[model samples]
Target: MSDDMLRLLPWTTPDGKPCYLSAASDHSRLSLLADDVEAAQLDSGEQVLDGARAVLGDTKAGERAVRFALTRATESLEDVLRIAVSRGERIEAGET
Candidate 1:
């Protein structure tokens, strides 16, 4: 099947394995669940960004606090990028 038939879900399995659904319809139950998870992740990432900025801007924030904020921000960004890349790849394949 073409890569376009594969959809990436935001959340992983119970065992922490990445979950991917192979189907042509984006309106399927699994697809809708994935969409919901993606929306939650995006919202979480935004919160992380805001908190990270606050921590960075605070003069009294300790190194450990800043480090933790940065770490969380990095992880959130990575997840967002992975989702974007997966969608982008499918789009690119479709255009070729």
Candidate 2:
């Protein structure tokens, strides 16, 4: 398959390797599922960012609270970054 038709999925393997999808078409079943997953990930990332900001702004946020927020923010950042790379590749490949 051509690079234009291949897509980097929003998730990874059990061992932390990246996942990919060889979409048959724009509206393929797997492609649509991936789109849904990506959308959810993006939304979750936004929520995590907001919560992290709130935690940071809190004058009395304890160590545990700050740590938890930071951890969640880190995970969200990873997801968002992967999404960016995936989308960027698609655009560059003229698949957008």
Candidate 3:
């Protein structure tokens, strides 16, 4: 994967734990924490994996979504931070 893809979603672990991933030239991964279910609405490994596959999916689709959202090659770092914070808040609030 290119730097742009890395900057887009930023691979994470399945339990919402943050982890570094190699370039996604072939595959992509995201992690979720057990506690994220109460927030993000993703409860199981299957759910997490499915969600990742749906949203992140293959390179072409992922790149397209990112580009459409950001209207640029890179996803805004600030947006990523905001999303993380919002998800955390949702969990804390029991909104998920």
Candidate 4:
């Protein structure tokens, strides 16, 4: 199948490579799972953003706290970007 026909799943493999789903339709079981995963990722990203902002706003937050928040924010950013790319591809393919 063409790359456009595949979906970039929310999770990756053990080797840190990207994962794709080849569902025939969006309502398939795998597709539904992916949808749930994507939603959770997005929700997590929002929570991360809120926590990072709180950490940044606190004047007494130590270096370790800032570093930890930065690390979490970076991970959430990667997830959100992946979700954006996946949805954008689907839209461009007229699958959305």
Candidate 5:
């Protein structure tokens, strides 16, 4: 990965899962996970491949699989106010 790609922006999906967006050569991909998605116990790609092959039914599926978890967080007063300012006017009572 290049330096530009390494600079990720932490975010969350609509379902509330923690995630990060990173730029790639061919695409921009997002990973939603419980912890630091980039830091895995397996340091080397080869090690990951070997372990995955043993556990997963298919090596390809294992390679493609990603782990993630949904979470909720409390917003600070400032953040709440900022959010309210941004969208407070757009919302209409009883309109979902």
Candidate 6:
């Protein structure tokens, strides 16, 4: 299988484990599922960012709330980075 077919799973197992799958076609079941998950994650992240901004704008917002939002944003960013790096590496390697 080519590295280009490899995908970084958006979510972990029920027990909290990382998962990876590879498919020759993006239309495959696994690939579609991953796409759905990535879309969800991105949507959720956007919401989180909006919420964070609102909180930051509030004069009553506490440090704890800001910290929590930062933490979640960091996690979402990490997931995005993982996906980007995986795809970038595969492309750089010219996987076929």
lDDT of each: 0.80, 0.87, 0.41, 0.90, 0.33, 0.76
What is the overall TM-score of model 6 with all chains considered together? 0.73
Give the candidates in order of TM-score, highest first. Answer: 4, 2, 1, 6, 3, 5
Worst 10 residues of 1 by lDDT: 1-10
Could you tell me the lDDT of residue 73 within candidate 5?
14
Give the poorly placed runs of model 4, Cα more than 4 Å off.
1-4
Candidate whose TM-score is highest: 4
Reference-based TM-score of each model: 0.80, 0.90, 0.22, 0.92, 0.20, 0.73
* Residue pairs whose backbone atoms clash in candidate 1: none
As for TM-score, the candidate ahead, 5 or 6, is 6
lDDT of 5 at 40: 32
Candidate 6 lDDT: 0.76
Give one digit per residue, the lDDT tens place, for model 5 in 1-96.
332333322333688554333444323344333123322312333354454444455444532342210011112222333334323322432143
Regions more than 4 Å wrong, model 6: 1-5, 13-17, 93-96
Q: At residue 83, what lDDT does model 1 achieve? A: 79
Across 1-96, the per-residue lDDT of candidate 1 in tens digits comes to 263567667766899677778877777788788778777878999999999999999999999999999999998997797678667856776777
Scored by lDDT, the top model is 4
Lowest summed lDDT across 10 adjacent residues in model 6 is found at 1-10
The digit string of per-residue lDDT tens for model 4 on 11-37 reads 899998999998768888988998999
How far off is residue 95 in model 5, in Å? 50
Candidate 4 Cα RMSD (Å): 2.4
What total of clashing residue pairs does each candidate reach? 0, 0, 12, 0, 0, 0
